[model samples]
Target: MYRILCVASVMLAATTATGGTLDEVKTRGALNCGVNTGLVGFASKDAAGVWQGFDVGLCRAVAAAVLGDPNAVNFIETTAATRYRVLNAGEADLLARNTTWSFTTDVDLKVDFAGINYYDGQGFMVPKALGLSSARELDGRKICVQEDTTSAMNVAEYFKRYEMTYEAIPVAGTAEAQSLYLEGACEVYSSDASQLAAIRATFAAPADHVLLEDIISKEPLGPVVRHGDDDWADLVRWVLNALIAAEELGVNSANVDELKAQGTSTPEVNRLLGLEGLMGEMLGLDADWAVRAIKAGGNYGELFAKNIGETTPIGLSRGLNLQWTEGGLLYSPPFR
Candidate 1:
């Protein structure tokens, strides 16, 4: 907890180096969100060319909070190699991609991770025919990994620490890596477990592949913004917190209006729903900001269940993503 505070303090200080992003975004009348090039269940276009997924849902929520219109956003597709460059260059306003938050990215890249929306870990996937049940079994094998990502670094460190030597087959993007892995360009593929699951679900024979039961590195993925815009950063962070708190407070899309109309004795719920607090005004928004956001696409859990839950093609169970009361890591701070 102390370490987390230290990191947050450093980020707060580091972000003081720039300013005025909120006014700029408001003036533009739309939020430009940077997302993955084509990672299914996170950010991918549907048949209608409309971006819809977990990450995309966050972008929409932010748009709704700021502009009162969830569709008032332009999703800018970014590769692992270009996400930071695009953000720092001001080409994108906020990056809601499944970007991992690390010390290097936070301090060195001069960007801030608003908050963690997904807690993931690195893992490997291989053909079921390999007869390998553990990552330790792959002593010397060719591995496909995406370049310019923590996956590449974590896998390298894992092999080194385990005293194993393997050839690295680097790919520029997820699509290329999937194609190569499917074509037998590499014997194994290493990435976040969620990504491996999402990718494997798209394969012709998903059951033919096996995700090894080994978690290599901690990956806290979330929304990112450039430095020098503390107000915008705070707004982004709190908007996410609003969604999370809404879920925890039992205020979802279906009943937000009803709850708001009836009024609540719960202070937290009232503050969250803009019922009896200046929370929205404090963020330079109208009282119904969170209402708009929640109405945009339900709450965080709803977005998750809709985009990548057990019923979806991604088929991801809310293992580490469940609310705190449900014994997972998701916890929202007090709205007051």
Candidate 2:
């Protein structure tokens, strides 16, 4: 039933989606990408004014796949409150912001999730001084959260399920929520575990905060597009799949070119690199589409490592994000 609804909406999107967002993007010479206002490891601008991160890489990869230029993207900064409005308004061609996949947004809001690029879960962070180690102990405490996000709802649901009462402090975004939490206006800060890590890593006193081990809700964050254009939707879906598939096929940015050179001998690799199958043509792209996207910023694994790996300040281990062969949930459908 869920799949049926998604397909019906996707078909509606194909006939009416964005009124030709792809064409407009082509004429405008860029893919307008909706990104977070400033999340350090997910979607933030660097010192050179270059947008670089895991989410940013996906946007750039999509741009490279479509516009033939990785840099052909205008990153529109948006908040949790405005991210959906920004995409629905056609102000952005794609939203690679760390938006979670939910049933409401998938069907009710007319947005189609491309795929789950990052499997995450909602968790809480509090100062060590609180002496509270478990989320069950958060009763009656003040929690800071961004408005218009799943984190907000998840917090409420978890509390309700626990029959616990707490003060809900709603802020405009993560930055504001963090500020209030740091300033002691709120005792708890709740968001995706990855985001909590990103927020804490940037803090001058990183050791002061502790992320509770209890994950309250699943958060499958990924790219989203307004429903209506099947061709555009198909292109986005395949582009994302291409990235994951590249990783599965061992075709990183460094070796994609070499693998392309050594063609049909490696059937699966050839199909992904767009050398053998009609995959690229099916998506209205050239044979080298996935190559350009992958080369834009290595494969999925490479992006995760550079942006927010254990070596980085965020210091997250690729636990559930590891490829399926390695006992993780990160798997791509066969490119055949």
Candidate 3:
């Protein structure tokens, strides 16, 4: 019995030694955000090597809210296969890669998706010269797809459901898949619809290729953190919610400061921006947490517009991602 007690005490000491991610992040003074190597609208480095995108904006917002510095983040480039490994290994405090949130990934991978930032779906892109207007037309085409992603499985299922056959040329990353497709090594590139648009924009002749209208699978892409840290997870989730709520409340980066100073009586806005309440304290942060996040980047719609919306190079329509107030599905829970 004494030996068992000694072993139990040692285990308790070890558990206490490995602090939670929130405490570790507070101690380190920065956040490690895992992102894709380069996906134009989602996450990418510019000519100056500064990371920027819709997903990167979320990382910055979280850093701003937590560390009080939007740029206080280290961007770790990771591929689909390496993303989860990096998070599980403690290399990243948050996985902001444009990863799909699925039941299998959430339950089996031991990671929690904080919230859905982007609603996307798997799609097929082919050269316009192929005269294949629909996904059903590709019966036995060679397809370039990312290995170890839902894209591969979704593409296969899509074909099988149509009683078709095809050859899958698996690539390790988006760039590789784009290269193979551009070289005519594969007749089609299968990936998220937004990714297809981004890849097409990079091609020498964007007009020569076309993404099919069919959206095969539901891909709710968002930020993820390692499981077992509920406090940290709540912080991330509410940060995203704050962005969405800000948009719903007509709050933009340009007008945030003005509105905060004016001090509106709206309970939702007050709770969100912490102008009249202590919502941030619930998340173990100051009342100005959401304000800092908004200052880091604009509201959700603004970020989407600046990065990947129809006005951007990727030229994506809001489609199902528009706010419920605007006839879409982007409504957020009330802050109050």
Candidate 4:
């Protein structure tokens, strides 16, 4: 009897130690998501002080999968210089800001990028009064860019490639860059093209500004989590994969529950929605984890449409962002 009790206690302790982030999250009852201070299509708070955007939707989907409540999220607004610090310091469970997936960030920052949710490129936005038709025309001009980001490197590279000399004024965030550009402190504002469009929509005089046609560098933005936690990483990665899979399987938020009840006819959908497999269990979650996530915000395409699609003020076209079948690079691995 004594030996049995001791073995039972040892097993319990081992289970507790190996439970990973899922157990920690269940005990805390909330997910901490790091977001931008204010970027329209990525992450921003509304008049009611509620956060909503494409990246924010990803956070909500994770929360729904983990905590079963889409609103069980704590948004921590962070700047480019501080986002990685916050994640590495354990201040956030996930970083869903508009961060580019690069070799340095992935390897040196001690963080794991789950997947690329947005395929973007850096561009320049300038006032139409400048009569500039291309980025190459802006020689020796002051460009406002975000500090501690890939934008600065891309800006330097673009200028070097064109044999042009220019002054780059690094701002702390996107809002500040927009402000500096609008106040004529800088000749151009440089960032992602989609972000430029979002900022242009909020301008007091939208028609005054135009985005230059040159795309300098690739910016594949995605969610990130701390390194050395494979279970947590898998949970986040699969949640994103489920969103993409749901879109591929023709599932949306409105019909998610019905599909869940009826069960999926397709094997891929069955494995994704946890109808016939233990995929979620392998990631330390229940079988219906993907189902809960899809119910929270439909699929990736739906989330994009509702937040930053053509109908929205961002008005972005799915040029290189369409799925593999649609001739774009937005394909995901099979759920099985």
| Cα TM-score per model | 0.94, 0.93, 0.95, 0.93
Candidate 1 Cα deviation (angstroms), residue 174: 0.7
> Cα deviation of 30 in candidate 4 (Å)?
0.1
Looking at model 2, residue 176 earns an lDDT score of 88
Residue-wise lDDT of candidate 2 within 1-336, one digit each (tens)?
Answer: 999999998888666654487777778999999999889999887899888888999999999998899999999999888888999998988899888898988988899898888999999999999998999999999999888778889999999999999999989888888889889999999999999999999899999889999999989988999877667777887888888888887889998888888775768888888778688777767889999999999898999999999999999899899999999999888878
Model 1 per-residue lDDT at 241 = 92
lDDT of each: 0.91, 0.89, 0.90, 0.88
lDDT per residue as tens, model 3, 1-336: 999999999888666534378788889999999998999888898899899899999999999999899999999999888999999999999999779999899999999999899899999999999998899999989999988888889988888898999999999988888888989999999999988998788788999999999999999998999877778888999999999999999888998888888878787887787887778888888989999999998899999999998988899999889999989888788887
Give the 10-residue window scoring lowest on summed lDDT in candidate 3: 13-22
Which segments of candidate 1 are over 4 A away from where they belong? 1-19
Most accurate candidate by TM-score = 3
Candidate 1 local lDDT, 65-171, one digit each (tens): 99999999989999989999999999999999878999999999999999999999999999999999999998889999998889999999999999999999999
| Clash counts for the predictions, in order | 1, 7, 0, 0
- Model 2 Cα displacement at 223 (Å)? 0.5
- Candidate 3: TM-score? 0.95
Q: lDDT score, residue 122, model 1?
A: 95
RMSD of each: 5.7, 4.6, 2.2, 4.7
For candidate 1, give the lDDT.
0.91
Give the C-alpha miss distance for residue 304 in model 1, angstroms: 0.8
Most accurate candidate by lDDT: 1
